[model samples]
Target: MIKKALKTAFPYSIPILTGFLFLGISYGIYMRALGFSAAYPIFMSMLIFAGSMEFVTASMLLGGFNPIGAALLTLMVNARHIFYGITMVSKYKNVGKKKWYLIFGMCDESFSINCSVEVPEGVDKGWFYFWVTLLNQSYWVLGATCGALLGSLVTFDSKGLEFVMTALFVVIFLDNWLKEKNYFSSLLGLGISLVCLVVFGAEKFLVPAMCMIFIVLSLARPHPEKEVA
Candidate 1:
């Protein structure tokens, strides 16, 4: 069962493998450039596992030691995961102990694939979810370790490497947009986020945007009676 799950999950994670390697390596290199040892990136990749937050954390570490600031920033940056978690509650409910790891490892890529991809006949859903999450994190950890180890040996321009993550997000959004039959949710989210961005400005928009999106989505969800009719 585990073998079948791993085999089934690997292909789905290929895109994430490529993206995480480049981005993760870039993160490691960034940490190295910031004078952090390899252990920093390796452990951060293993534990934090949040690409964006990990990058932010490096900056925070260099700036000063403020646990309050770090905690708040982490919540703001990852507030969207709240929605991801809510959406996943039903799917992850009956997965047994694997549910805990599934929640912990529910990075954007893992959530995206697991949320959307259907399990094939005879494959264990729980194991498939577990393998996907494990594989994705493994790729990230390997990439971070590699880049950190190589950081001293190789020197080149990494000026624009940060944009790789943004590019990956764009690709993921487009892929989902194309696959979705209902554009209302997508349009609403994009519109609300844009409005919030303009109103709150780049530095302070995310949390407000997420809050509004949640409120609006909850109201927009059709009632059971409406769906039945």
Candidate 2:
């Protein structure tokens, strides 16, 4: 079952594999440049699993150690997962115990493929989702470990590489926008987030933006259905 799932799921994950490995490596190198050990990235990639938040946490670790502040920041950065969970709850209902890991490993890319793709007749949907999650994480961990270890030996400057994550997200948003004709939700999210960021400042904008998104989306939910009909 594992082998079959792996074979079936791998092709779907290649783009993520490429992107995650590059971003993961860049993340590790950033930490190393900050005087952290390779184990830091490895453990973080394995445990935290949120790419953007992990990068933000690295900077946070260097500054201060306020547990309350950290907790709030984590929630703000990962608030979108609330929406992802709502969308995925029904899809994940019958996956048995694997649902826990599926939820744990539910990064954006993994969620995209699992939620949208239909499994082949012979493939186990649960195992296919599991492999997608597992393989994506493995790429991240591997890349992070390698980059951290290689950082010390490399000679080039890697200053400003954190933009890679931002660029990656832009690419993802654009991809989804291009794939679907109805982009009201995407446009709404982008417009609201940008306006909030401008008004509230980057550090303080995420929570407000998320709140606004939830409220607006909730109100507009029925409109989209009506438009489709």
Per-structure clash totals for the candidates: 0, 0
lDDT, candidate 1, residue 109? 84
Model 2, 1-229: lDDT tens digits are: 8789889999988877777877888889999889888889989999999988999899999997899999988988898788789988888878789889999999977887787677898988889999999998898898898889885675555566545455656766777788888989999989999999999998788789889998998887776656766
Kindly give the stretch of ten consecutive residues in candidate 1 with the minimal lDDT sum: 156-165
lDDT by residue for model 1 (1-229), tens: 8999999999988878877887888888889999999999999999999888899899999887899998999989998899899899998878899999999999988888888888899999999999999999999999899889996686666576556556756766788899999988888888998999999998888899888888888888899787965
Candidate 2 matches the true fold with a TM-score of: 0.80
Most TM-score-accurate candidate = 1
Q: Give the whole-model CA lDDT for all candidates, comma-separated.
A: 0.88, 0.85
Please give the lDDT score at residue 93 for candidate 2. 78
Structural similarity to truth (TM-score) of each candidate? 0.88, 0.80
Looking at model 1, the pairs that clash are none
